[model samples]
Each structure stands twice: as structure tokens, then as C-alpha cells.
Target: MITVVTNVDLFSTFQHVLQPLTLKPLQVVLAYSGGLDSHVLLHLLARYQHLYPQHAYLAVHVHHGLSDNADAWLGHCQQTAAALGINFIAEKVVLNVGRRESLEAQARTARYQAIAKHLNNGSLLLLGQHLDDQLETFLLQLKRGAGVKGLSAMAAQMPFSLQENCLIVRPLLTHPQQMLVDYASQAQLSWVEDESNNDQSYDRNFLRHQIIPSLKLRWPGIAHAVHRSAELCAEQQALADEIAEIDVVTCAHSFSGLNIAGLAKLSKIRRNNVMRFWLAAQYLPMPSRHHLDKVWLEVVNAADDANPQLRWQAGEFRRYQGVLYNQQQYAALKDVVITLEHTLSQRITLPDNIGTLHLQDLIQDTIHNKSGVDSSNAIGDNDSGCCVKAPLAHDKVTIRFRGEGTCHPVGRSGSRSIKKLYQEYQVAPWLRDRIPLIYYGEALVCAVGLWVCKGYEAQAGLYWHVTRER
Candidate 1:
């Protein structure tokens, strides 16, 4: 059951919730919307700011260009914030909606992205989602038969952005819609009413205006009870996350991927749990259940040489030599060859701006057999040094991306084809041609980020060590 709350009582609640915030230094920014809920939140925050002057307070209004009154809303937010003596920032964002996609979802995504740009290392993005909104979210998730994570609905506090370290807090989660409206009326705050909110074509509006009101009439305490259930789901989700975390470390083949052998040992549900958690933690879009099933059946369980891949909107899952790879984007490769001069201190930029390279000093004593020589620890003794031939100005230092040659890298027992070496290094087939091969005259000398030919091994006394930095 919900209790009738006075504006004073609401202020007390807000003050109580904000106590934890003062322990650490944070830039507090309100996600302001010129609505009853947000207006009340803004008013209360403004009032509270005087008591806690140590914390920085700011407001950001996202202008999602869907409504004709968007400009007016922006104006209202700025004006109101000015009257309250608060700093205000307004951001305009374009919504790119697909023909069949939900315009609401796309607008929300665009709005959050625009807001995310303003948030940095230590930011607290205060949102104005109240109990009614939480109820609506829970109902919607239920209708769609969402799992624990989804059914947990919006938390009072949670990580806001996938790309940035920010926290979104809904301090008014327990504040009823009536309490906010009453506060707005008592304060005589001016707010613009968006006409789109009344359009029942939107699912939220339908639930808010048409469905939830009728349900509330019959069961007045439903919102509070549902919120309690959501809280319980949140606890359950946390426990599930703990199990997944332990399992992830066990299943990891390399740094980030699940070893198919380790993964196969888990039950199907556990595997799915880890996969979903892994994707979400890595900031990659989680595949739909259908797509996840396809990946499990086709890619993870496929033959060693199957080379199966699954792609969705934002990322792709690939299998490379018995390991799974989730790549956010394929690196753009360039075919253009670059000409560079060899100088000890000269750093050359590679073509297509792939990366930068330079001579990383020369070492004595270590004629690099299998790499891993510390140039910093180079010994100057002639007996320990492999004498290197300095590049003559007449010899053109040509850098080519792709070449057909049978060249031997220094200290390797036998000469292998470059194509074979690329495979041996497990370089992606599409990226092989993009690895720049360095040549002094017609002799293949080194492949940047790869190997130096045997003949071109750093000769003693100040032999050059090629270093590639991306």
C-alpha cells in the first residue's frame, strides 16, 4: 500500500537518498525533463543544493527532435534552471529509426547517447523515473516474457552507459505520481506537456492511460507489491551474476573468449548465462535467443575447421582455430605501399594510418633468435654483438603491404613462404595482405609487427630493432 506523502516528506526522502552521495566527490547532473516528476525533482535538488554546496550540481536536457515542441521544452528547462540558479546544458540529437523498429526505443537510445557524451569519469546522472514508470516497465517486461535480468526492471541505481563509467540514479523510485503532481501544483512550477504522451499508439501511453489505470482501480496496492517483486528479482539476478563470474574465468580460453572444450562441460542454461553475461560485460550487443541458439549449435559446436561466424547489429562472433572471437569492428585494411627511409631515431607512419613504427634502438649480444630481447639491456662487447650492415643512401627502403616471396626470417631453421608464415602466425586471411613487408633493395628484410628476415638480423654494435606501435 502507498502512503500519501507531503512535499516536506518527499524532500526528507530525497535528502535521505542523497546522503550516500556526499561521501565521495562527484559531478551531479540531473536528467531534466519539463514534466511534473522532473520539475519536482529539479526543484527539490535546487533546494537541497544550498545545504550541500560541496557537490557540483548541473542539469542536462536532451532535445530528442521528435516533437514540434522540443525547442519550447528546451527553453522551458533552461529558463526554469536559471530561475532556480542552476547551470543548464541542452543537447540536440537526431533519431535514426528503422522502418520496422520501435521509434520510442530508437529515440531513447539516441537520447541516452547524446547525454552520455557529457558524462565523464565521476558523474552521477540523476533521472526522474518514479514508481509509476517502474510499474509500467515491469508490466511491459512481463508482457514480453522477459527473463530475470529484464524482469528486474529499472534499479534505483545502476550503471548508465556501456562505453562510459557513469551511474544513473532514480531517487524518486518510491515517489508516487500523485505526490509529484501535488508537489508541482503546490510549488506552482511551469512545465510543458508533450502531446505525444497522450497518444495511445505508443505502448507506454496505452499502459499509462488505458490499461494501468483500470488495473490500479481494482488493485490499488499493485504498484508497491510489483516493485517489491522487482527488488526480489534484482537480488536473484545478482546471485546469478556471481555464479557466471566464477564460471567465466574457468571457461576462458584466452583472455576474453570461452574455450569450446570448457564451455561444452557446462549445462546449456549455464553456457547461455555465461555467453549473455560476457557479451553485456564487454559492451557488445547481446544476441537474441534465436541467434544465441544458432551460435551455440553452429559455431561453438562446429568442426575445428568449420570457420563459422554469427553476426548481429553491432558485433560479430567468429571462430578462429578452436577459439571464439567477438569483434566489435573489423580493422580497415589498406593496400597502398609506403616508402620509408631507415634512420635510428626516425619514426615512420604506416599507410592507411594503420600504426606507427620506428627503430627501437639496437642491442649488442642478442642476435634475436625467437624475439624478446631487451634493447635497454644491450651489451656493448663486440664478441656478444651480431654486426649489422647500415643502410646506404643508394639503397631504396621500400615498404610493401603484400608480396610474393620465399624469404627466411633471421634464426629460423628453414625458409617458409610468407603466405605459410602468415598462417603460422594465425593472422586473419583478409589482414595478411595489409601487414607491411619492409625491403632494402629487392631483399625482403622485415614485416612490420611480424618478423625480420635472417639476413637482416640486427648486426652487432648498434643494430636496429624495428618496433611497431598501433
Candidate 2:
């Protein structure tokens, strides 16, 4: 068994993956579950630790807090790590297995989140999934009727920006489960067995126990053949990615929305492909086939003046003001206001959603300060002299919402309605009400985020400063 392990040194195989990615001074974090496969990996890693002193490594076991033996298993992992002279980290995570989300998806999400927290740039998270597991994943993708990218299954070395600079390397992807088990038995390695593996409740387990066995007996090389199919899918995906990059460059607009005319110019097949590719790039989940088909029809077939709107769990897409806008729900804010006295500066923390402000100039001394400066001492002859000085008075500050307001910008005496001002500015109707208008009691001093009221406009030889949290 030692000879077999020596001959198939997983460490050296991993090295080739690392050098190309420059994933070194390597910090290899194995997602150790105390199960047979990961246990074998931990054992192998410990064996080669001395040879790779420059590489930092650890065994991370995520205790899902699901199974009853979770505590015991965590303890076992700690003991094993201590005995083997390798560092061990255990994360106790709450699993949110909802009715809509499967046990497999929930567990994978929680486990990856836990591991990701520990990884920094240039580090790698290793999973114990072998060739058989890859074969199962490929079959599952087919069951869902996934596209080429999904059928590509897992990559040998995946670089994830979990932190500023990090990469995840799966060295065991090419190795078969049988080979790992054989090596473990030959070397007399002890590992915990998860009873869930035998539970047919899980789809992957059902496939492994019932479907794969029958298929393998008939084909004898089903796993290897399916694995090859996944590789071919991955190669096709590379070509698709190149083409998608070209499409993205052509159709993407200034506001990160799609250019409707440019998109319409593409061939129907390419349009659909590029739309799916664009949504996926934005981390938006794909809609159903029928929904996508509808989307294409609404965008391409509809009259130019037709108002097109579509929604999905990920987000909504609407054709408005000549641009295709993909939108998400924004955080809302409480209506509040703070009033600042003339010649006084104030620092105000804004609510999550209330950011913009509508304003009116009230007094001759009132000044609008757009200077990006924090509250400071008021110098009588300093810039922002028309507004309050820094070290603002505490008592008079107040916050209020924009209701009816009117203001004449500098060089103009006639007041324009706040509603008309916003329209002229082209502020989206969805965003206009959310902008907070700052008031010093009854008087509007400055807008929380947007322009300060023209009356309170900061000017040279004036003594006022305004501070806001971005």
C-alpha cells in the first residue's frame, strides 16, 4: 500500500496544477469530512508534508450540525490531525435545507462558504471528489438537461477569488474512488464512514448505488466514457466562451445594460446564446427554456415602441427609455431629516436607500456645499463661507423627506418645481422618492446625497462645510 501511494504521489500531480497558476508558497486546505476519501487525502498530505516544507496546509472539517455524530466526528478529525502533525480547523455551520433547496445543494453551499472564509489569495481548497464522483455529477447535469458548461462538470484546478487572491485545486479529480480505497486498505488507514452515503434519499446516492452499478455492469467502462464526454463538453465550452466575449463587447452599453439595437442585429441563435451568456456573467440564475424563448420574442419581435417587461427569480428585465434594464430589489431607507444652522457644519449618516435630495434656496446666507470635505472649523473668510462652518452646532440639525419644494439655481430667480428638476435631470422615477432631502427644521439645507440647496450653496469667502457618509 505504501508502494502504491508512493507510485501515485498525489502531491506531485498537484504541483503541476499549482506552478501554471503560480498558486504557490502554497496553502492547500483539504475539505476533510473524516469520510473515506478525504481521510485518505489527509493521510497522503501528512506523509508528504516534510518534503514540501514551503507549502502550508490544513485539514478543514465542516461540521454541518446536521447528523447526530457531528461532534464525535469533529473530535476524531482533531485527534487524527494531532497524531499526524497536521493543522486542523473545524467549522460548525447551520445548514439551511429549505423545501425548494435540496440537502445536497444546501450542504455544498454552507460547506463552501465555511471553507471560503478561511482561504486568502493564492490559497487552494482541495475537495476529495474522485473520477466516479465526476461521473455522477455529469449524469446529474444530463438529468437536469443542463447545457455544455454544466456538463463540463468540475475542473482540475479552479481559481476562485474567495479573497483578494485565491485558487482552489482539485488534485483527486483524475483518481478513481476504487484506487483510493485500495490504497487506504493496503496501508491500513482508518476512516469514518458517513451513513448518509447509503441513504437513497439523496439523488447522488441513488445514482451511485442503483443506476451506476447497473450501467457499469453492462458497459464496464461507463464512468470513463462519461468522463470523456464531460471533457469534450468542456472543450466546446472554451470555444463558446471566446465567441461570447466578442458578443459581450459588441452589445454591452454604458450603464451595464444591453444595447437593444446591437442585440437585435445578431442572428436569432447567436442572440439567444449571448443573452444567456450575459445573464450568467452577471451572476443571475438562468430562467426556463420557455421563459428565455419569451424573452427573445419580447426583445426582438415586439414593435420598437412596445414596452417590454420580464421577471425571474434572479431579477427583472425591462426595455425602458431605449435601454434594456436588468433590475434587482434595492434596500429601502427610513424618512428622516436634519436641519443645519447658517455658518454651521454637520455630519449626517444616511439610511440605506434614502440617498438623493431635492432642494430650495431659502436665505441669502444659505449655501449649497458640494465640496468633498468633512466638517471642520468655520473660518469667517474661508471657502463655503455662505454655508455653516465646520464643527457644526449640534442642536439645530434635522432631517426630513422631500415633499413640495422649489428652488432657483444660481443666476436664475424663477423657482422650478422639484418634480420638474428631477425630470430634467433624468432621475428614474423609481429612485426619485428614495432620495432624502436634508432640512434644518423647516428650511431645506442640503440634499442627503445629491446637490445642496442653491440657497445654501457653498461659496468662496463663506464659512460652512457639509460632511456625508458615502
Candidate 3:
């Protein structure tokens, strides 16, 4: 079995798995740790690259700085990759652990982000997680009473980003830890053994050192059986996703919201499934069973006139006026005011990475001619809010949030207070305070992106049009 774990089996596996990749162009990056598993991965990939020279093979090592010998491990990875003629890069990231976050999880999150920086639109990130690692994750999820998604464990292939363009492929997921050790031995390859792995205080380390060995002693094929069970869970998850896809199309009308009525029609199990897909689509954290139950009963089944909400560790969901809105409450956006420079077109980065504010000045006649024919070549939202006459040569323009009083909005009947208008428009409460109010001195000009005050409507000359993009 040790001899069978040679480079021959490794290369054969790579060839069989990557045959589809030759159809399109994409960079393959190995997540090298200079550990036994990853070292074997890099060694095999370096040899296989000789045959498939058409593909780019690179290795990335993230120096988490969690271990005392992290610097030494990074150096070894660089030297080994250089000797194999493989392009190597190293990134150092600090784990920002808040009061609620654990160091282990934070380090993993930071490490993945650091590595993802090097990947491009169609990159393939190869992870070195193997069968033994999968078993540890399975047991951990089981102990926590995780749902189907968690029980599925690590996938052989998965989208690494929300855009689904980049992929994370675990090529060694089927191979056992001992096979990697033997393969490294067969090629006389050397690697690091992290001291932290021996620390049983960590959940995975405890499972690896304390529980799994004893289980394997009783059932020799325990690892393989657990992996097979994980595969079955993944299949069930896929089927559930298919059901969610159909239901999501019915309830999911927009990117940021779902239709309340459509969701109410789904069965409890189906509703939870759709909710999971909806949250996952937006890259929000998945809530647990208890929180999800509260969301279904309170949020999904609330009265049409009632505003019901639920907050979990990841985010919050609210239902209002027959619509459901998903809010990432934990990701606090800066509540600061940004000035609008009227002198030129500019893009301003919003606080808390909300998105960018796009400001461009436009001319009224340039947008549409007096005869209803296209006239001036200026851009406009065809509304008074976006069609303000350009600022006077001496006017100092600015943008801010929160204001009071009444004004007739563009394309509305009668003047109304901003507060009443907010209720009339059925705007989400969270957004009412965050909307940017544009001002030209004492008089209100426009509610950026929402409405333009009546008196400030553009007539003929150039005006400012502001938009926000996420």
C-alpha cells in the first residue's frame, strides 16, 4: 500500500480529475503549507506540470503568524517550490479576533482571504485537505448537531467566491493521511510537522489525536465509511438545492429581498431550504436550526401589517409590507457624512464598504430636446432629482444624511413631509436614516438616489445626478 502511494497514483489522479480543465484557461494554485499532505501535493503537481505545460501551476503559502515557527515553515515552502521550478508566493496576514470570534476560525478566514488575492477570475485553488481531515470535520459537525450542509463536510469541488467564477478543488480529499506520508517518503520529500497539531485543546486536534484513532482501531475502514456518508449528505444537499432553486425563483424577486406572500406558500421544510439558498446566494452566514425556526415562525408567518424580525449571529431578516428584507446588521456601516464636490465627476467610497457613490453632472436639454427629440448628449435619470441645473460657479455643494420638514418630490402629487413620504413609500426603516440628503445651502436639493425636492428640480442647464453602486 505504501508503494502504491507513489507519484504514479498521484499523477494518474490529477490527470483523471483535471481532464475537463484543459477545455478552458485557468490558473491552478496549490495551497502549500510545507506540511506532509501539501508537500506531496506540490511534488506531484510539479511533475504533472511537465506534461501539461499549457496550464499555469503556482503555489501560495499563507504565513498566519499563529505558530512560533511560522516563518521557518514559510521559508521551507519557498525553497521547495523553487527547487521544483514552481512559481511561489507568500502572504502574511494578521488575524483580527474580536471578543466574539475565536482565534482558530479567524485565522482560517484571514488565511483564505490572503490566498484569494492571488487568484483571478477563473483561478482554481487546490486545497490539501484529505480523507482523514474530512473525517475530523464530520465528527466535529456531528458533535455540534449540524444540519445537512455541515454534515456534508469538505467538497472535492466548490465555488470559492460568490461570483462562482473561481473554484476550490480538494484533489487529495479521497486520499488518506498515511498515503500522503508514504508518498512523501517514496519521493524522499521533506515537510514540516506543525507543533500545534499536537495541542488537543483545539476541536479538530482533539478529534484527530484522541477520538478518531480509537474509533479506527475498532473499525479499520471507519474513515472510508465516514467519507462515503459525507458523500451521501452532499447528494441530499444537491437535491434540496434543486428544490430551493424552483422555490427561490418564486419568492426571490430581487437581490436584496424576497416576496413575503410567495414564502408563506412554502412548507416549513421547503421554506427553510429556500431561505438557506437565499442567504448563501448573498454570501451571508448560515443560521442554525434554532434561529432558522424562529425566522420561519415569526418572520415568515407574521401578519401582513406587522413588522417581524429575527437576528442571528450572521445577520438579521425583517418582513414589512408584504416583502422580506435581509439585513447584515453585524457589518456596521460608517454613519459619516460625505461631501459632494460639484466641480467634477467623481466616485466616492462609502463608509463600511457599502459601495461607491457615483456623481456626474448632466444638462437637461442635452438629455432630451424641446421637440421630444434627443438633444444634448448629457446623461439623466429623466427626473428632476437627477436633472438639477449645474451648480453656480461659486456654490459650495455638499451631501449629508438625516433631515426634517416637507417638500414636494419630483413626480409626486402635493408637498408632504419627508417622514410621511418615507412611510408612504414603504421604505425599510433601516434605510430611512441612511439615505443621503443633498443640499444646496439652506434649501434641500434632492434625496440622493431617492427623490429630488420640488423646488430644486432641474429646468434647462447642467445639473448633478448621483447614484450608488454596490
lDDT of 1 by residue, 1-470 (tens): 11224544777888888878657766788888787778888888887787777778888898987888899899999999998877899998877665565888887777788777777776888889989999999999898778888889899989875324678888889877888888777777788898999999988899999999998999998899889999999998898889899888877653256677777888988888888888776666556678789888888878866878777776677776656667545355445556765455445666553445444335323444433444544322222222234566787776677767688866679899988887776565655665666677888777655566776655343333333221
lDDT of each: 0.73, 0.67, 0.75
TM, every model: 0.74, 0.72, 0.77
**Clash counts for the predictions, in order:** 10, 33, 4
Backbone clash tally (model 1): 10
Pull out the clashing pairs in model 3.
366-376, 388-463, 389-462, 390-462
**TM-score for model 2?**
0.72
Tell me the RMSD of model 2 versus the true structure.
8.7
lDDT of 2: 0.67
Better of 1 and 2 by TM-score: 1
Residues 1-470, model 3: lDDT tens digits: 01234554776776677767656656889989899888888887887677677788899999998889999999999999999878999999987656468788888887788888888888888888999999999999999898888899999999886323788888888888887777777789989999998999999999998999999999989999999999999999999999999998899753257787898898889988898898887777778867888876888787767778787776678876667777764333234556655445566665544445555444433444332222243334443225565666566666666667888887788989988877776667676665556666656777665667776666554344333322
User: What ranges in model 3 sit over 4 Å off?
Assistant: 1-8, 96-98, 162-164, 253-255, 298-309, 330-411, 414-421, 433-470
Candidate 2 stretches greater than 4 Å from native: 1-11, 19-26, 298-308, 333-470
Candidate 3, overall lDDT?
Answer: 0.75
Tens digits of per-residue lDDT, candidate 2, 44-128, equal 7776565566788788989998888889999999998888778999998886666687877789878888888888667777778
Sort by TM-score, top down from the best:
3, 1, 2
